[model samples]
Target: MVDRPNKPSAIAPAASAPQPTVDIADDNSSITATLPSGENVTVLLHGATVTSWKSGPGAEKKENLWVSEKAVLDGSKPVRGGIPLVFPIFGAPPANHATSKLPQHGFARNLRWEYLGKSTSESTTSGDAGTGPTDNSVKLDFGLYSANLTDEQQDQWPYDFGLVYSVTLSRDTLQTMLNVRNEGQLGFDFQMLLHTYFRIGDIGSTAITGLSGVTYTDKVLNATEHAQAENAVRIAGETDRVYKRIPQSTTSIVEGDKPRFDVVRDNLPDTVVWNPFKEKAAAMADFAPDGDYVHMVCVEAGYVSDWVRLEPGDTWEGGQRLRSLL
Candidate 1:
């Protein structure tokens, strides 16, 4: 009692004063934020590379590299996929509609993405550390605002438009929303793709559901082909097709053995799936040799094979959702 006499009675104030918080890191080359649910996400501003995502216990350590770092798409071989945002065309020049001088896939994909901001909600489903449901997670928004090109870019494609690409990563899903604002006086025509690459257990074991009646430009077959399966179409070898005239709000299911991922496009009209199976993998240097084929697959949503014309003051929005199921 004597020792405790000097201590004031333990009583809490009406409300603990708001804790002093540090500002978010906004420097170029890196963007980081702590969500309301305590989850954290970071992106490398330089390459718009997703650096880290973490939640729960084992999070004393965070997971990094949402996209491949080693894979560089210069002229040799591209990353194959992973929401690359290809525009105008897909493959290299001399082979496809693309031209070598146009900066393959247009300049949007390669441009540096700016950090718009971060958002969180308790609405997302939560999971444990090592083995928990990362499904229904927080949505982090990162985007690039349209800017007048430097002397360099103007020499390539001369057009003025406010192009904004917003990429949101949730627990079970990853969504990319593109808003192309026509700010110029002239109406321009263009095509785009949300080249998404999903990690797969085995390329041969999986299939993509949806796109039953849709017609596709078979880049490999050199003709248009219809979907054979309504549920999921399995990937075999060296597949390259541009499914066109697809309606918005379609589901593309990627099924594996235990964990399956379904890519649902909210308003995407096209889907392109590619897997350089044998000879192509060997011919390309960016690809991880033949042995690494089992790791990923590209199912892209695009306007390619179909041209979209945007008039001045008009805006076009397109988005894709990546949902993973166990």
Candidate 2:
């Protein structure tokens, strides 16, 4: 884990104006958002992937997100940690689809995105300061269209589509939203997810709750179906599970007896809980040192169990909100 200093707060008044400002350098490919509350969220255009979200009070500041120490930042490959957006396909693409030629999680996380616009309380009714903690919300939008696709990329999928992804930062929570619009004359099927990697002081001391009785496909067990018998799921080794039909409630990765963070989802019916453990972590060059799994956990939210179908001129939306409760 990268050593980070705790700031006093991530919520406050936007400097100079009420509207939140988006910062991006032409020479640099990364985007940095500074909210009024001293909270900061950084993202890279290469993948439209959120790389860092830091916000909390003094002395006990918290870094809710996590990234691998050895993860490459030069855009050669997908960064191993933080929140990587997955689209078009989840695991391996089906051999029948044109998207099959793409990468494991499709090209959404590997392709660059164009910045749209930002919104804050000053410019909209959504963000109103002093309206409780939620008043500090700030939003940034990034778009990717099929016209920007490379020759090889077009050959891979060939579907004309427009995707606008948004990252909203507030006090303790960082919210993600994806809007998919079909621009082609034909319909297309796709899968999507926000692969979120959370920082854990100790994975051994952490357990997840709010998934009891849910049915899931155990990827580690060769796609066998099973019910979650335990109220709180704990990790002892390599775990790759795809939970289906998840409700729009709160799920959390608790540390010891207390909940450390919360993952709230909407329009997303799938939850992917994974940890590569020791052996797999050592095998991946992107994963730093050894035993890197001991410090992180992934509780992804998406619509992956069944393909989402979108007709021409239609749009679909999905979202996930991450908050640190500790």
Would you estimate the TM-scores of all the predictions? 0.73, 0.89
For candidate 1, give the lDDT of residue 243.
77
What local lDDT does model 2 show for residue 98? 59
Candidate 1 versus truth, CA RMSD in Å, comes to 6.5
Q: What does candidate 1's lDDT look like per residue over 1-326, in tens digits?
A: 35764777878656422221113454455555554334455544433544444444443533311245456634233344344666544554333422345666666556666656655433313555534333333444555543634566655555677766665655445566778878878776777777666666667777776677777777788665656545456677788887777664665545554446566665567788777777777776666645566666777777676667888889888877665563
* Residue pairs with backbone overlap in model 2: 10-37, 10-39, 11-37, 12-37, 121-127
List clashing residue pairs in candidate 1.
29-45, 83-195, 83-196, 137-171, 207-233, 208-232, 208-233, 209-231, 209-232
Which parts of model 1 are misplaced by more than 4 Å?
1-27, 32-69, 73-81, 88-101, 124-148, 224-231, 256-259
* Model 2 misplacement above 4 A: 1-21, 122-134
Backbone clashes, candidate 1: 9
Cα deviation of 183, candidate 2, in Å: 1.0
lDDT of 2: 0.86
- Kindly list the per-residue Cα lDDT of model 2 for residues 208-319, writing each as its tens digit: 9989999999999999999999999999999999999976467899999888889999889989999999999999988976776889999999899999999999999998
Candidate 1 lDDT (Cα, 0 to 1): 0.59
